[model samples]
Target chain A: MKHSASVLALAMGLGWSGMAVAQEMKAEVIHWWTSGGESAAVKVFADQFQKAGGTWVDTAIAGGANARTAAINRTVGGTPPAMMQFNTGKQFDELVENGLLNDVEAVAAEQKWKDKIPPAILAATVRNGKMYAVPVNIHGQNWLFYNTDVLAKVGAQEPKSFDDLFPILDKVKAAGLIPLAFSGQKTWERNLFNAVMLGQGGAKLWLSVYGDKDPAAVKSAEFKNVAETYAKLRNYVDAGAPGRNWNDATALVIQGKAGFQIMGDWAKGEFIAAGKTAGKEYGCVVLSKAGGGYAMGGDVFAFPKTKDANTLKAQAVLEKVLLDPTTQIEFNNKKGSIPVRLDVDTSSMDVCAQKGAKMVADKNQQAPAQELLTPPAVTGAVEDVISSFWNTPGQSVETFQDKFAAALKSI
Target chain B: MLALRPRLASKLSAWLALSPATTILVVVYVGCTAWTVWISMTASRMLPSSTFVGLRQYDALFANERWQISVSNLVVFGVLFMIASLVLGFLLAVAIDQRVRAENVLRSVFLYPFSMSFIVTGLVWQWLLNPTYGIQAVGRGFGFETFRFDWIVRQETVIYCLVIAGVWHAAGLVMAIMLAGLRGIDEDIWKAARVDGLPPWRVYVSIVIPMMGASFATAAVLLATSVVRLYDLSVAMTNGGPGIASEVPAKFVMDHLFERQNIGLATAAATSMLITVAAVVAPWIYIQSRRRRAA
Candidate 1:
């Protein structure tokens, strides 16, 4: 009996050590992609991770702010997830600064992300000479999604620039269709303002106001033009615009009741859900006359600091799976975004995404979005100013400019 | 020493009985409040830090247009909502107290709105108030092409829309409280009033209202609490829009705390709200205690 007991102990010890060598790579990922298309997009990453011999644990909270809060709380409280999603911006800056995030420098270096990813995006992911997040996709935030049927009926050509936009809008309004499908919430209001700033004010003024934080740029005549143009477009929107969701506003365009909507590429998800094809039933353009650039905003996954060896292995594998060229195409295609890596083939994506990819490929036209440029506090303050300006018809452009400058100066 | 031992044992048992409540009050309530106040004075963002920034956050809060609008809007909403809810609820209770038939059914109907959450109430009101596909559209469909009821979409009138929904939601709760108060009135009071040939409204205004002070206080306190924490309603209804016109103090704090990542500002706003409530309630509490002592 004593000899058998000794043999059994030895067998158990060997089994435990053998299991450690082939430990399970289980990654618990927290994200906000709970919608139909968003979930499908996320499943691509899950499937690929599963194929890579890892388990994908999804904790999809419905709202971005809510999911980030849960993930941040868990991380700070020391029981962190293997990975978490953040918008590709300063959302996770403090996490990185406080060393709560593990730098993915190894996988990033292996993939040569610096040579492949756009400069603006690569800069957003890298901090303190190390990459702290793996950027997954690039969403063009300033796209003009218009109804082709409405434009043709109004005898209006698709506008290539802001100069032609007013005429088309006027024609559509005169034809008794809603000229602009607008969502009046503060976020969309700010997005519309950014679209105008990027298209009309050009990239130089865009960088000056947001990136350089130059007060003079906000007070310039060029900015005044952008402000006046944005306000004028407000006249084209119907009274029902306020408090409407972005997808509902997109529905107006889809039904041909409205002419166009200035929204992100994600709006295409709504159109696609309605069985509308891009460039046919609806049209899309990144409107610009000069210095036009795609306003790039997207998602990234950051690995929370964990001492568990299995978790570390999971993070490394998930990072590679997230940015693999094929994974990028599959994920972003369903996500209604372009691949973050510019070298990938975007042939399978629709025309709108293809256009966005081409625009992203040009290094000169790569404009990082407002979130990439400013902290959330500052962006929110500026957004409040923009919403007030948009909704208040009597406010002068000069007064709006001063408020905008003051908002930009806020912390 | 033996006689004192029995009293001492009872005293120890009393302390043991009260320990859990006292601990919860100290740790959860007082402890968190102290932490929040400390966090407010620091330059904290998404995460709390120990670097103190004095009253800089308070200064910023005072300067913020959104916060200023929030405070003023709260005052407006609080005053209107409280008065409207109390008057409407009192009238409803009085109506039902007139020996009306089907009283139970009517009571349930009146109290149904209270059972639904503010989120549901706000959504229902939003749909009913919207201009395009809501009431106005219905009116237009009836060939009233010029019909207009677009208060929810307008900035100036949006807070009033919130008041309307709030009063609708809370009046029912107030009605139930007032009805119980009315039922608690002595039978002899009504009999004496009838014998004295007093009209119902005069009796209600002069005698009954003055006597139901506890009920009025209870309803007002409930409504006041809701007014201070008026977040989900505004979020569900206008989302502080048509351009931050319907913003409230609680929504401002929540936005800064989470979405905007400005914990210092959020906590400062929260602390300011606490101070404001204390300032208002302190005098009331002092007067109440003095009145009770004199009686």
Candidate 2:
């Protein structure tokens, strides 16, 4: 009798699993969005997918590189999750080339994503004339986030350009506050350098250096000026800046200990988490002395190829849910980025995001980030040069420019 | 014939049991190594491709400034770490071997750092060496306003900080090994030295250290292996910061492998490391084997 009962229970479990397989659309998504704000942003998709009668399976990996490596390995190993996340760039280029990823062309065409999403983001997803990934949001990579209280304490106004920022930084320094809340890691160093390039050298030089890989562009006087500006700003960073994390630097600004932090729009998530409203406690701006542009980078979910019918169905559902206008607004609100779909009503987003949306909508202001222009290899090579220059204050601008040109051409 | 049959059966079973591990060693280690060498010659980026580019990848790797820095940093770290660990460990063992009080506790304390992972040791050292909140801050709090110990933040001296942490973590293990060697020295050796009117330091230098050759070899081999695969400590402590000054070969290989998405370069770096290790080990291995044969 006991054996019969055990068999019966086993049969029931099998029946339930079979039922789930036949009836439910389950998507196991692997992503690196494990931060508090990032997780909340991802939850919007999960809830929306559930509302659309699909089950959401969450696999939150902590680091971007680790998550991508795991996802790429699993996809290659033939036991991939239903969907995976990548920074909206060439990270998934090989997967697309190898035909390991399924094209979201059908969903994209059906939803008219080409019309809704920005051309730059759309172009990144559409490799070889077919959309292989779904861009979810656009993050402005260069935003000067300053504590309003800190600036007010120093009797400084909001700096609209890089030229205006130096004097404000000086005032902050003279007042005994850290002029720049800086993270001294390689990635942040590169980010700060890029911010300087976009603001001082303008979008043309930014694109020429990264997009064209132009050696002459690096040798130009504008590039040297940008290099000099980045070096000059290094003077304001504290001794504790080395090996510091990005959020810790952001925390310094939030606590009014520092005057400014040149970071990505994702820093908004930190401000939101701290319950400090933008324009009141903290202010955000994109500085451009040369009529600069908004440097855009963001996340995308690429669906790995699968023969399973239910998994394919689940991917389809996820694609639509990710791009739904309302969902896009809601997700980006928590994500600290603008919706990839520029047509969406963004009044619900904060003032910072609204400003980003305005810049993204303008053709001239829509600057592609370094990742979008160059592959990870070139980006990293250039990043090494930037970091070396930043860390070594005595390095000359001409040497930096020469090194930058060499790095750009290294790959 | 009956006795031979049982012995043969036992030997066959042993061979059968060893087959799996032997197969794994050949396939996983030797096979993957060959594959890495092959991939290093190709124009592989995010994934391995068959577009062979000869020694182009190696040329690029050598030309790369970061790679050069990483190689030199590894050399500096490896030499300093091994020598310091050996000297410190030997001293600790000798001090404890003097039949000091609480010898058991002292032995455990010496071996404790070895039990902690490199990551933990690195983090603790990073905190201790941090200028703002670490030793310098503590010194300033005591009114030593001119105190300074910020080597970890400087590019020129950051690698030494790693060596310092590496020595701290590894010295204990060395001490344990040396202590065992010291204990194994027959008590009669000490009595003989006393009869000859040899001082303790003289006995240790002339007789005991030479006798502890095997112990020193064992400890050196362990420390050398750790030196070659040093990744977590540098990662945890500095993450190759201050403009790639503290970067090492393993970190270079790893960063290129996944983050940079340049498998060809990564594999090339890996192959270079393999060749370096093999070049150093091959001669020593041959000498050791020749000596064993002579014995």
lDDT (10s digit) by residue, model 2, range B90-166: 99999999999999999899899999999999999999998879998999999999999999999989999999999
Chain A fold similarity by TM-score, each prediction: 0.94, 0.94
Instruction: Kindly report which residue stretches of model 1 are placed more than 4 angstroms away from their true locations once superposed.
Output: A1-22
DockQ of each: 0.81, 0.72
Off by over 4 Å in 2: A1-23, B1-11
Write down the lDDT that model 2 would get. Answer: 0.93
Query: Candidate 2 chain A, which ten residues in sequence have the lowest lDDT sum?
Result: A14-23
User: Clash totals for all models, in order?
Assistant: 0, 0
Best by DockQ: 1
Clashing pairs in 1: none
User: Compared with the real two-chain complex, what DockQ does model 2 have?
Assistant: 0.72
> Residue-wise lDDT of candidate 2 within A52-163, one digit each (tens)?
9998989999999999999999998877899999998899999989999999999888988898777888888888899999999999999999999988888889999989
